[model samples]
Target: EEHPDNPGARLFLGLTLAQVGDLDGASREYKESARLAPDDPFPHYFHGQALHTLDRLDMAIREYREAVKLAPQDVRMRLNLGSAYYEQGIFESAIAQYREALKLNPGDAYIHYNLGLALADQGRFEPAIAAYKESARLNPTDPLVRYALGVVQETKGRVNEAIGEFEAAAQLAPTMAAAHAKLGWLYYNKNQVPQALEHFEKASRHDPDDAQTLHGLGLAKLASGKKDEGILSLKQAYQKEEREDKKRLIRSVLVKVGALSH
Candidate 1:
């Protein structure tokens, strides 16, 4: 109130409001700050952030574009714009912005990971893998990056490579249910029942409600001759699964095993 004309004060006030979950009030102050200092990019950038959080994505994009135009060299501005584009499923625009961000700061692991995600969405598996590899190289201990790399490898039909990456991710973060679940599926497919059971059990311990883990656990148990346990696990998976096709698969397996009547 004391500094109505001060753009900096308005910007700080906007940030505080946003931090306190007063997004509507924050947006108003951000707009005022931008109006007061049209040449400054921070107000627009922060406004874009607030709009992004509110999921007003198109409006967020507009503000992000304005901020980028005012500060072309700012990597963070480009990254946030890319993420907004990604969320909108505009893969081409997201990839372009991520590439530009990479040019500004090639060493940023997160930027490379974002680029990989955009490429992967477009089914550009080769380039996606390359981007993910660079991200992993830059941040080797990041389990999410390792998990992403494993997913791409799996999609490309490189099961052994996928298993290696998933294993690394699981080792890096023991409670990473997704990685363990992927490992379980891969090992199960390779006829390694014990390994499959081990990983599936680990995944279930971490994420007890995941239907996929339950399904895999059931399959591994069946393969290993644990009839009652396998049927129980399959029943649990069938009950929890939401996808029609997956539920049908579990039902068919149960029918074939004589646990469910035709």
Candidate 2:
């Protein structure tokens, strides 16, 4: 009560509350701090952080915008604002903020990766590929960058290139279930049953609940003449699959194998 007019005191209280995981208390203190010192950007910035942590992206974006207005040259604020916009599906706004952040800190691999994600969300695959490439160049050991590059290549119908990227990603991060699953899928499409089986088994080992991996494993088993095992795997995949198209595909296979009535 004695420090009613003290913005710094309120700000300090907010920080303490945040440190103790009292998000609602921290938020109230931050609001009071901002009210006491409307010109100070720190309160708004901290408020944005709290909101973002709570997954209140709309409110976070608004607070971040206020912080940006108060400190336009702050690169970290721009990045945070861009991330908030990305979370809200405002890809163009995110791109603009990411571009500005890149100009301020060109060597930031995460900024490039985020720019790629925004461009990908807009379906601008060509530029998205370039951004992901730059991010991979800057951060070579990052398996997610390699995986994203693989996905874009696949989307562009460059199956061979996508296979290469997925292979590298799988090698770099052996436990990455998605990379192994992608490799299995590509091999299956190429009619390389043995190779597909190898990757599918690895993928299933990493994520036993993955329907797509189970589907691939079933097909590869059938191709290798393991009819009973293949039927079991297909049944499991059908049970686990939630997507309509995938379920239809699994049904078609079950019918072809005489496991289901036509």
Best by TM-score: 1
**For model 1, which pairs clash?**
none
1-262 per-residue lDDT for model 1 (tens digits): 9779999999999999999999999999999999999999999999999999999999999999999999999999999999999999999999999999999999999999999999999999999999999999999999999999999999999999999999999999999999999999999999999999999999999999999899999999999999899999999999999999999999999999999998
> What is the Å distance of residue 235 in model 1 from its true position?
1.0
lDDT of 2 by residue, 120-196 (tens): 98999999999999999999999999999999999999999999999989989999999999999999999998999
TM-score of 1: 0.96
lDDT values for all models: 0.97, 0.94
Per-residue error (Å), model 1, residue 47: 0.7
State the number of backbone clashes in model 1.
0
Per-prediction TM-score, please? 0.96, 0.94
- Alpha-carbon error at 261 in model 2, in Å? 3.6
RMSD of 2: 1.5
